[model samples]
Target: MSAPPFIHLRLHSEYSVTEGIVRLQDAVARAVSYRMPALALTDLSNLFGLVKFYSYARNNGIKPLLGSDVTIANEADPDRPYRLVLLCRSLQGYRQLCDLLSRAYLAPRVRGRAEITRRMLREVGVDGLIALSGAGAGDIGEALLQGNRVQAASRARFWEALFAGAFYLEVQRYGQAQQELLVSETAALAAEMDLPLVATHPVQFLERGDFKAHEARVCIAEGYMLGDPRRPRPYTEEQYFKSGEEMAELFADLPAALENSVEIARRCNLQITLGKSYLPDFPTPAGVTLADFLRQEARVGLERRLQQLFPDEPARARQRAPYDERLQLETDTIIQMGFPGYFLIVADFINWAKRNGCPVGPGRGSGAGSVVAYALGITDLDPLRYALLFERFLNPERVSMPDFDIDFCQDNRWRVIEYVRQKYGAAAVSQIVTFGTMSSRAVLRDVGRVLDLPYNFCDQISKLIPVEANRPLSLAKAIAAEPQLKARIDEEEEVRELFDLAARLEDLTRNVGMHAGGVLIAPGKLTDFCPVYSADGGGSVVSQFDKDDVEKIGLVKFDFLGLRNLT
Candidate 1:
């Protein structure tokens, strides 16, 4: 297909956490339907949705431009920082972008927001990146709005010098106050500096009607009523996904700006390697390969376990034959799959936990079916006695990464994590980050509160929704299951509006969190594989990507879950 006249250079997916409502699948499908040849996902400061976005775009024959809408520290007033959109033009730019983002999160945050400084940007170097002045939120635009053309000009010069020929003055026409002024000033500055102009629509939702739902979502996050005069309204309904023709018409006066969006898409070509495992290298004894060391350790461990099971010599001999066969079969499959190091790494940590006086639970999950795990003491269950098939754990027919859910005494789980961090460099180890989404019942309560409804009334309506095992049923299912909920929706106009808005906002991310047990150990620096961020309230360093995305980018995840009963 021929390239569309204009492409989106700035977009925020649902992975933008609470601020965006565009799902990656929906975004890519829309792009394909519009016949756009390429699209960019510049989620706010995080690359959490990048791998999935890239995969979806590629599978749909759309080029994926990887970028981030990052906040740079404004030295004059640290609390109010400036934003810039950085797009990767090559693999090296991707790596640099990851490093910069990791450092931003690692540094001391201002008011709980991660930011990088001008010096940090230069130190990291922008070798293969395209910079877009963040339009109204950018430093230049902010300065111009304040009637300080000198500061805006100075900021523009610095960025132009830093990004060289790759910097573009971004312009947007969203129906916001002073937007026309910013646009005219930006165009003039671009002309004065001889910089290219690029048009972008800061997409937060998929359609125009999603604006109110997005507003309700923001109110829920900020603890404010939707109608409260004090509440901030930074977003507009016009920020939905627009076709290339709409964008071209929006910037018709300066056609070059629209053309530059497609030009930037052509420049950014980031190819991600997926579906491969990158395991941390386990140190083996001198003159012994990883496979040999694993075999030696498993054999010795099995002999010790066998003695505990069978004291009589004749009984031991009779029981040993099948155990030996199972161990050899499992070991060969593990080695063939190039996962000896993975098993060895898991065994080392579990053994360390045991030796350090921390109570460890016998293995859980499909990994409990492995004879090798039993031999290595990674699991206490005897697969042979239970007649568990090793194939259930690691099937030679269907190759996949083996995951063992290890439980430790809740109080001592952090000790195991620290031990792993020391054994593997700290830069190589990080906790996985998880996103808390708005559930059906919670969304209903939130929408009601934001709408200034009576507290007891909202609570009454919410309680009618069915819950199973402490998890609230989906609104559709709950409404079907409960006649009271259906009656309220059908009888009350306010109730119906609340339900309709809640349905649209439900399942979108509401907050960030750390996964209880999932931790990643990369082969080298974790930043080399993916960016890392400090969790909320200044907690441990966490991977920006969650559990599934980490594996998709080739990082192996190990679970070190804590169980109070194990204590």
Candidate 2:
């Protein structure tokens, strides 16, 4: 039995949030392991993991397919629920796809759910693109299942006309009996309409055995008791990545469907590149360069600050030694580092906040070590007076972003954010996202609940595990450090099983929340650089990447942190 020639067109990576078990690198490695030359990653909707996927796949000798699973409203009936899968075949197609997805989310009425209209797709659908009549949840499949084959065929024709030769009837065999019937009907319909057929298993994990862990993840996402009979369980355990051979066996009766997967993979040639940072031009007053403007502001600001601090000093003494030579050197270093605009932009916001009667902190972090920042009103603390080194803040020894951790009064933080949105178009500014992982304690409790263990018993076992807030303790580390925990795990089979499952699920992203104060301001719409997501029920827009990932993509993240101490 030779391996079946097939490539997975609908695969989810870890960026699919809790529902996806395969990491991007792991997914690419799995494709290479299986000898599949190409693979597609259609994670939910956002392309947050595209760069990682593209780079990893290319470096490891595998072709990367850029695709998205986008939700759109039905044309005739606006309330109908369904989504379409679109894949890019060229750079232009990828850009158009991005534009469509962006509009789907940015539209005023497209709140809560990301959705586009069929009309919008018709307008934006370009050449060299492929459309997969989605699996069970797709518009055509739903209509077919609802005894509306005519409507289903009609919808298929609509897409067929829009996508021309780039459309295929998608078939999946996840052990669902309805899927078998749907596949047969879909094949017959395709034969009648002269459309191509493609096979995909809708992979969510690396292998079959991972289903249990994936199920637990699903339970975590739904906030459901794992053992609760009423909770909705996955229709099949076969959602794992099936090798080409497995897919061939599954679709043995329809070899073309299996072969079409390879054909589709060959057709998709989109490659994502991490472009240069698009930092907005900080608006300087007319007739002055940003550097000159910043210097002028700093000079005047320094004199005003000195006057306030030493009002009793004679005018002659003030004029004799007005500017600190060391401070001027620090300013030169800042300007030379190409951060004058960054400094000016930050200072502009802080000044705007202060002028509006919003309380601002003196300063936070190593940014307090810059007299240049002090003079520019980016920081209020005089570094010379505090005996702070400018090198510690800017690090001229090694080029790096000069981060000023600014604090604002809690009551007026949003006003400052609004000012930024107004100053730099609303599309240019956004907050950063942070993922909450299942910590050691959280995993223990969740696993215990799933196993139906007594709460007090689980609490006792958990209490034995020491709490380390900043530094998390692994099970092995805990066992080595705590005698009681090691003894219990060795003594009881159930306790051991609980520990086993907890250990597996621990440190996985459990939920997403907004960063306390980190905001990423881009020169263009944020989606062009990185995907944006809503944060913490606050309606605050956030980048999908954390602070580190944002910097990796070459975007400067400003921490407009709120401090309660100011209150």
**Could you list the CA RMSD of all candidates, in the order they appear?**
1.8, 3.5
Best by TM-score: 1
List the candidates' TM-scores in order: 0.96, 0.87
**After best superposition, candidate 1 residue 512: deviation in angstroms?**
1.1
lDDT for 162 in candidate 2 is: 88
lDDT of 1 by residue, 1-567 (tens): 564589998899888876888889999999998999999999999998888898899999999999999999988998789999999999889989999999898887788788978888888899889999998899988998998888989999999899989999999998988989989999888888788988899999999999998888778877889999988899999999999878878888989998888888888988889999999989988899999999999999999999999999899998899889888888998999999999999999999999999999988888988988988989999987887877777887898898898999999999999999999999899999888888998889999999999999989888988989999999999999999889988999999999999998888777878999999999989988899988652358889888988999899999999999998
Worst 10 residues of 1 by lDDT: 533-542
Each prediction's whole-model lDDT (CA): 0.90, 0.79
What value of lDDT does candidate 2 attain over all alpha carbons?
0.79
User: Distance from true position, residue 73, model 1, in Å?
Assistant: 0.2
Q: Kindly provide the TM-score of model 1 when superposed on the true structure, using C-alpha atoms.
A: 0.96
Off by over 4 Å in 2: 1-4, 51-61, 74-80, 90-113, 119-129, 146-148, 253-255, 273-275, 303-328, 395-397, 469-472, 535-538
